[model samples]
Target: MKLGEGVEAAIHCAATLASVAGNSTMPGAALAESFGLSPSYLLKHLNQLTAARILESVPGPAGGYRLARAAERITLLDIVLAIEGREPAFRCGEIRRNGPVKLDASAYIKPCGVNAAMLWAESAYRAVLAETRLSDIVAEYAAEGDPRAFAASCAFVERHQRPQKSNPTKQTPARS
Candidate 1:
């Protein structure tokens, strides 16, 4: 049930992008550099976000990245799926059938409380994630500071970044 780091990184990167001013875009390298991460590894997460339609990349000189949509429309689950994928976290292996004493269909059917409980738990987990939009989290963060001010800081990052150089030799770091 453990999610990958890309899931958290994608969400943070997307949320940061959402805070920037409309005309500006932040490069993936800069985002990585801000956290001392390798650019190659970060690109994988960025590409996931792009595939999810959460970001649109601008190439060439003066080019970078920006959100494809408004912050309010995006959700934490969207970023999670973009990076970690939408696969169910808990895959029921149906181990109940693997035992030496396999029960008959009549004995194994519906009234099994385990399957029902697992279904209920899975639904509840999904429901909470569905309701938790990035905007809601941003709102909470903003309340701690000032939304406009935090956005302005993100704008500063966008404005101050240098163009990333293309590096053919760069490779994604192996996860430890």
Candidate 2:
């Protein structure tokens, strides 16, 4: 089965977010530009990630988005679930019951072999994804990356990113 739209983008975006300095946020536009994707298209995926709590949004001129938690704690399965949902990809309609070869109704009582196989495959796939986390990806990148260049790239992202900093003097009064 094909991956849902924006799944790749979400992973890449999350990786970039993980590499950048702590508490730093990057605007959707800049992230989209970096990936050579349409801002609107990327925004849709970013919204999905935010809804899944993978990324947290910060508002204001300097505000943007950052990871809600450590990248190591967020698995590929989590991202897949956030985008594709928890529903099974393959749904069996029990078409065997409707075919020309009408079998006894009692035969329908058991699980279909094809359906069972698909479910098993899905579980295996999910298990693999669950074991892979964003940190593992970043670690791989770090392993292959040139130290100076990697630092520079991260620096560039940090330079372009607008950090969301709260103004101490601008705190709102608490309501009774």
TM-score for candidate 2, residues paired by index:
0.86
- Worst ten in a row by lDDT for model 1: 167-176
- Looking at model 2, residue 148 earns an lDDT score of 93
For model 1, what is the alpha-carbon lDDT of residue 121?
82
Estimate, for each residue in 10-34, the C-alpha lDDT of model 2 and write its tens digit.
9988888886565778888888887
Once model 2 is optimally superposed onto the true structure by TM-score, how far is the C-alpha of residue 134 displaced, in angstroms? 0.7
Candidate 1 lDDT, 112-131, residue by residue in tens? 47767877886787688778
Off by over 4 Å in 2: 145-152, 166-176
TM-score of each: 0.78, 0.86
lDDT of each: 0.73, 0.83
- By TM-score, the best candidate is 2
What is the alpha-carbon lDDT for the whole of candidate 2? Answer: 0.83
Superposed model 1: Cα runs more than 4 Å off: 145-158, 161-176
